[model samples]
Structures are given as C-alpha cells and as structure tokens.
Target: MKSAFAAALAGAALVLAGPALAADPTGLWQTSTRSGQVEITKCGPDLCGRLVSSEGLKADPALKDVNNANPRLRDRALKGLTILTGFSGGPDAWTGGSIYNAEDGKTYSGTLTLDGTDTLKVKGCVIVPLCKTQTWTRLR
Candidate 1:
C-alpha cells in the first residue's frame, strides 16, 4: 500500500512539473513603443513570430519610390514575415535566429530571451555585431 502511494505521488509530481520544463512561448507580445504586436507560435520543432497588429502604419504599404535611391526599402512588406526561427539555445531563451526590421528593410541575426511572464528581450545589430536589446511586453 505504501509503495503504491509513493508511485502515485511521483506521478503527480511529474504531472505538475511537466509544463514548466517545456518552453511554450505561444502568446501575443507587444513591442516597446506599443506600435505593434507579434504572435509567437510553435512551428514544428522551432518557433515563428508574425506581425498581428500595427498602430501608426497601414496593414500594407504601397511599393513606391519615395526615396529613389533605395528600391528594396520601398518595396518591403512589414507584415507576414517570419521574424524568428531556428531557436536552439535552451528552454528559456532562443539563439541563432533572425529578426526583421521592416522600418529599414533589414534582417539581423541575433538572440532572444524571455525576461519575465510578459517581457521578451530582443537584440540585433549590423556593423559591430553587438546587439542592442529591447524589452517587449506580452499583450495577452
């Protein structure tokens, strides 16, 4: 009877600890400026983030040559881009992923870390390779 009780307790403990061990970043997270939000979901063994909401800009902008020198910058779309991928660092953080900056039409390879229940630290850079991090709050 005691052995059976111990086994049941062990099973209960495992059940309680299971979800904590697994990394589930699925949620709606807001940007620092509250200018936009991204929905992060599990994509196979990896994770992918998509733009879900925007404040100051339209959903889709027209591809025009307002700034004639940069054609690629003018034609870039801010929505529906896979901003994060190949997360293989650990349970709480993601490393070796790319972040797309639609404002400049540039993609930077960087790392992401979960700071709290509603905060994500994202850092990306260009020339120096030293990332400047920003805390993104979870919206929902």
Candidate 2:
C-alpha cells in the first residue's frame, strides 16, 4: 500500500513540475544586430516584447518614430514601442504574432523560438519567400 501511494505522489509531482521545467523565453534579450534590447513578458494570455532601449534611443533620448508611414504616429517615441505583439504558445516555440520594425515602420508576421537556454530565434515574414530570421541572446 505504501509503495502504491509513493508512486502516485511521484506521478503527481512530475505533472506539477512539467510546465516549470519547460523552455521559457521571458526575459530581456539583445537583438542580433546589437542595436536594441527587447523585454518579453506575459500580455494577458499571450506574450509581448517592448523596445526598452536602442542605440538610437541612447544617442538621442528624444528619438521619434519619424519613419512611420502614419504621419500621426511619426511623432511617437521608440523607447517604449511594443515591437512584439500578441504572441501565443510557449516552452519551446511561440507563433501567431506580429513584429513591428521601427526602421522601416512596418509590421510582419512573426514567431519566437527558444533555441537554447540563452538563445532565442526571432523570425518575421511578410510572406514565405520574404522571411527573415535573427538570433537574439538573453541579457538577463
């Protein structure tokens, strides 16, 4: 009877610990180009990343999104821009999201994959033939 109870407890422990042991990509990450840092976090039931800092932002604290196609949004600041939006899934991969590029003032369908413990693969696509992938490293 004791052995059966021990087995059940062990099974329960494994079930409870499964999600925590999964690959998690939530943290501050440095871009492959070494131009900016994005901080990923939970947004409602999904994930989102914001541009916390960038080389341009560091150079001129008052940097604006001048290249934005929308003239109204051109004056918006880039420092707190929501670059990654409404990403779903986790552990190893995340998809069904959009990535905003301030440089071109464009948004692309994107995915975030946890490549390793300290590496993340960010992919953005306008279409299958027009996809771009960048490897970002964890900063914290």
Candidate 3:
C-alpha cells in the first residue's frame, strides 16, 4: 500500500510540473509594442529571432535598415532582420544575448524569461542598472 501510494504521488507531481518543464520558446511572437512579429528559432546552441512583419513593413514593402549604425548595412531590408541574437539558457529563461533596435540604431545586452507558456519578459540593458523590460506574447 505504501509503495503504491508513493508511485501515484510521484506521477501526480510529474503531471503538475509538465507544462513548466516543457516551456518551449521557439515560436512566433508579437512584440510588446504591437508593431511587429518575431519568429524565434534555434541557432547553433542558442536562440535567435527575426522580424517577419511589422507596421513599418506594411507601410513600405521595401523598408531598409536606415537607422542601422553600420552604414554598409543601411541598405539591408527590415523584412527579415535579425533582431535577437545569441541567447543561451534554458527552457524558461535565457541570457547572454544581444537585441538590436533599428529605431534607435543600437544593440543592447539582453535577457529573456518565458512567463508561463504564452508570455515572455524581454529585458535589454546598456549597463546593469539601466535596463528596460517588455512583455512579448506568443502568437503561435
């Protein structure tokens, strides 16, 4: 009876923990600004995201990276721009990444925390104390 009860308890625990343990960040997500969608995928051992669509893209089909710091890259299109790069961590959280903001023409050190299965907390900082956080919702 004791062994049977213990087995059942373990099974229950596993089922309860399943979703939290299986938080997969690879998917389409809407930016917090509601201005664009990013498709996140596995890149090497890290995760990265690319801009698949945006309000700006809809207005101008041939939108370029006009604000990019690199003058040579100014001609690159924003349709498939790599905005998130080199994020490495776990099933629910990630760090050691760089987030590029075309609006400001800057890249910041970034960290991501997957909140539940649908919400993601994205943070970027120029320095430790100077950080901004945004909530991104899963679109797929």
Candidate 4:
C-alpha cells in the first residue's frame, strides 16, 4: 500500500511539473531598450507577440508610420497585429517566424530563443540576417 501511495505521489508531481517543463514563452516581457513591455502569447498552433504597454511613446508626434504605402513597409503592421507568428519549432525555441517592426513598419524573418525563465532573444534582419537582436526581459 505504501509503495502504491508513493507511486501515486510521483505521478502527481510529474503532472504538476509538466507545464513548466513545456517552456512556453507566454508572459509579459520588457523590451531591450527598457522603454516598453510586450505580451507574448500562443495563438492557436503558433505564437503571437504584441505590445502590451510602453513608456516615452509620443502621443502627438508619431515616431514612424507603421503601415506605409511603400511596398517595402507592407509586411509591417500596427501595434494591433500579431508581430510574432508562424512559430512551429518548439517551446524553448522558434524558427520560421517573422517579427514586425512597428517603428519602421518592416517585417523580417526571424528566430526566437528563450534565454532564461523570463528572458528572450528576438533577432531579425535584412541583408546580413541575424543582424538585429533584442533581449527581452520578462515582467511580472
């Protein structure tokens, strides 16, 4: 009976720890610049990241046109669109993903890696690839 009880407890522990081991990057994160915060969440089978809040953002003088008429800026979307998508690799890392830069309204193919419990590195680029990398710190 004691052995059965021990086995049941072990099973329960595993069940409780499964989600943590899954390594889903769904949480609030602070931008590398320490200027804003973004919320990364799972969208259906993929992942989507968005700006949850920010500081030092001008209300009158717009920093940049996110959705410009220029073809080069077509992939970029307003803060409303999911910036991170098409993630199919794994919970700890994602490939074949795209990140939308709202500041410039440019979309670039990218990859994401969960650096720590609350840190993520998102890198995207144009010519060199893996040119622009930002370390996002998780927020409570």
Q: Identify the candidate with maximal TM-score.
A: 3
Write candidate 4's Cα lDDT for 1-140 as tens digits: 99999999999999988757657778888888637677788788877787655553434232334455476655443444466777667767888888776666677888888876777888887756447899988785
How accurate locally is residue 83 in candidate 3, as Cα lDDT from 0 to 100?
98
Q: Clashing residue pairs, candidate 4?
A: none
Best by lDDT: 3
Q: Between candidates 1 and 2, which one is better according to TM-score? A: 2
- Give the worst 10-residue stretch by lDDT in candidate 1: 60-69
Show where candidate 3 strays beyond 4 Å. Answer: 1-17, 20-22
lDDT of each: 0.69, 0.90, 0.92, 0.72
Q: Cα lDDT for residue 73, model 2? A: 96
Q: Candidate 2 lDDT (Cα, whole model)? A: 0.90
What C-alpha lDDT does candidate 1 achieve relative to the native structure? Answer: 0.69
Tens-place lDDT per residue, model 2, 52-120, is 988898998788999887889999989888999989987789999999999999899999998767889
1 or 2: which has the higher lDDT? 2
- The per-prediction tally of clashing pairs is 0, 0, 0, 0
**Alpha carbon lDDT of residue 26, candidate 1?**
67
Q: Model 1: clashing residue pairs?
A: none
Off by over 4 Å in 1: 1-23, 58-77, 127-129
User: Native-vs-model 3 lDDT?
Assistant: 0.92
lDDT of 1 by residue, 1-140 (tens): 99999999999999988756444566888877647788888778777798766663453343232332357655545555556666556467887777776655567777778865667887776644666787888777
Query: Which scores better on TM-score, 2 or 3?
Result: 3
Ranking by lDDT: 3, 2, 4, 1
Model 3 lDDT, residue 134, Cα: 93
